[model samples]
Target: MVKFLKITAAIVILLLLFYFVFFKYRQIQANKILIPATTQTLFKINVDELYKTLAVSYLKHPSQYAGTDKNSIREKIADLNSGLRIPANIYIYALKGTAKNTLFTRLEIADTSAFNHFILKKLALLKKDAHFFESADSTFGLLVNKKTVSIAFNMAKEPIRHILEEIHDQNNMVKISDSKFAQMASLSDHLSFQDAENLSKINFTDGKIDFSSEFENKWIEPAAEPRHRMLNPESTLSFWLNGKIKSDLTEKNHTMSLSLLSKDSFFRFYQDYVDFEWTKTVTQVDTIVGYEYNDDFEQVEKKILRDRKIPSITINLNSDDKAVSNYLKSLGALDQSTGKISSAMIPLYQFYFRGSNGNVQLSTIKSAKPDVKRASSDDFFYFKVDFKKLINQTSIPLIADKLGTFSQLEIKAKSIGKNKIKLESELLFLNKDANALMQVLKVFQNGFKSALDLNLSVDIPVSK
Candidate 1:
């Protein structure tokens, strides 16, 4: 019970109540659960890395993890290589010989459509006094006997009396050349994000939620509002998020822009407990990042930038540097320093090669309008967005049905001695501890006067 209370800390100040360790994110961290944000990131994992991850996991070869389709190779890549480039004249074999090259060099007849069309043009040119030739083998060429036979390869057509003949085929299939498939596995076990980096987006299909919270007052009696409230009314009521309110005892002059990437309803139910009403509607979606294929076929991706005015909630911050909080304001280092990301970078970049490679990017358009206003002391700058992009999938990182409008997310677990097992679960927008999060910080704002101020700090006292 004591530990439970510590995990659910609350601090209330006059006109403001700032909860620490926003329970949503905190609880998420505890859960070690991950969700991908499909709209604002780019991931280019080498195909080899996936194969390696699965190879080391169990008795089965991990090649499958990388995106191989052949069951015979299972997790083997001994012979397959992504770096090998093929020419237009060449045909690839999925499996070894039967007839033909099984695979062949680019045959003149290979590009049947283009060849037929070319022959038509050639015939027209011949009638127009173009010279024709034949090669030593009697095949038609630019010249007669020493000429070449360069007609289109489609025997199923008229105008060109021809027989279907395959020059030769190569014996090739997805047979791995080497036995040591583990050589090409992913070296890194964990996915890392950078500082000032946002990650793993989640979506709540319907009635999904999102939220952040902080805990305060671990020692106070359960649910006992912290002591800051009596001194600063603004601190206990409205949070700086809605609109800043004043409190003589509270620190002032602050600026902050926080983002919550989650299923629209990740924390909605919690807000419900607090009687907080929130709304979200996607106004406009702009595609920002698209692929510019280089000569090598490597993609130079442009990031997507979306302009969304989370309307209803006021955009009150003076950017990050100029702040209303004395602590933040006094810092000269907090200048309008630009970080790495910008207009050129792709915002919502995701790669899907599990079946076939695909890309999707979306930006928020300027046409979007959003407004958030606290009707009275009871209201906060509260809004909800189901950031979950349902790929018709319930699985992570894998879109199950390429043809269907859904994505599957499958959670798997393993105990050292237990057989590999997959689990089924669905995420929703409800917070079991929402009442605890709202208890963090409340806000009271008067557009004319500055809003309240309350410093929230969350400290966890248990070992997971």
Candidate 2:
């Protein structure tokens, strides 16, 4: 027992030592990138890493940027390393004063030796042609220090000098070794300045951005709430949003491409309203139609009509459900009987069956028939959108004819794996070989063909 206890105590001591060492290392690393919030908004971006990532992506898929002159592009990219002294780190701060908001950009240049030369060049150019800053020429000035060059625009020279003095004297400038913004920058290639308060509210991992409730209330709600009730002030939009360009392969099998993924939390409010329940019921009905109850459809339709609390009225001419069509015909919901569906039923059909084969058969309440033909597709998995129907439903005449010119859009997606889906989307033109728009399609097709050819053969020179 004594020997066992001694061994256990030794193990515990080693673990405690390891824990302290790890904690200390993490704290040191965190402190290295901690920056102060000097203004209402502060953004820190690592230009060196950003340029490197872009260069690698461009090398991998040189064909994507085909329209541009290749030699010129190479020269422009090379300039990043050629005596340009591009800042390793960039910070843009927006100072909100009582009178106005002043915007200042600070670049932490890698080499200070070329700083004076660069400033002199800018001053010489400004002297020759002051038209570049004719609007606020007097306010523009370059302040160069040990390793940083700060440029102030749209502000008086005295104020700019005073601000610089404050930064130097009070040490008010946010440092990458001390600010939360810098910590975030260290994790991601780019960061957007939201607010100074509550840095913990902004969480960054991989490429995903997770915001706290305060962030959602401040930024997201105001912009999205007006358009859709699904994204209300009370409703959650997305817990995590990620949009990143990958040069190297990711778990999702993406390389030299852009990927966007978001985790939506709107389903939390699924039971908040009757509309949501009805939507769920409609989805269940669709699933039932697809997988089971082909024979019971007649009984279902009859029961729906008899009950008058119709689950929903849907129009799908491709549907072989004679029972549902017959029931709608009996109620004058479909135009099959009298060559027109009633206007009273139009709104309900529009609400339930969003996308249909052609123009939504709409008529006045007093009108007996609709002039438009009813069409539908039999593909259960494929979604066909008729732009003409959408435009007619909105009744925006000015754009109606223009929108009607667009043919049907088909979108289909199939899950290829547990976390991957292959989406095939296409827009079909109504005019086939005759429309002038076909020429535009040909141009795009030719360009894509050229790009594919280049992708197979062309080699892009990547800078170190």
Q: By lDDT, who's the top model here?
A: 2
TM-score of each: 0.17, 0.36
Give the top-scoring candidate (TM-score).
Answer: 2
- Candidate 1 is scored at a TM of 0.17
lDDT of 2: 0.37
Give candidate 2's error at residue 394 in angstroms. Answer: 12
Instruction: List, residue by residue over 1-464, the lDDT tens digit for candidate 2.
Output: 99999999999999989966864554444334323245666655545444445445456545534444455544544433322344455555665551135556644455554544444453332432321221235566544556555555645333555554444343565655554454444444433354544332222221122332112211111111111112111111111111121213223332321110111111211111111111101221111122334565643322221222222222222222344344445665555533444435443322322213322222122222222231222211234455544554454565453444444555443323332333344554443332222222323443433212122121222222
Quantify all predictions' global Cα lDDT against the true fold: 0.24, 0.37
> What stretches of model 2 exceed 4 Å from their correct place?
1-37, 66-71, 77-84, 96-100, 108-140, 145-147, 153-158, 168-170, 174-185, 197-464
Task: Estimate the overall C-alpha local distance difference test score of candidate 1.
Answer: 0.24
Q: Which residue segments of model 1 deviate by more than 4 Å?
A: 1-240, 243-346, 349-363, 370-373, 377-464
Using alpha carbons, what is the TM-score of model 2? 0.36
RMSD of each: 29.8, 20.4
User: Per-residue lDDT tens digits of candidate 1, residues 249-333?
Assistant: 2334433322111222112111111211112223333456777888998989877877542212111221221122222224322
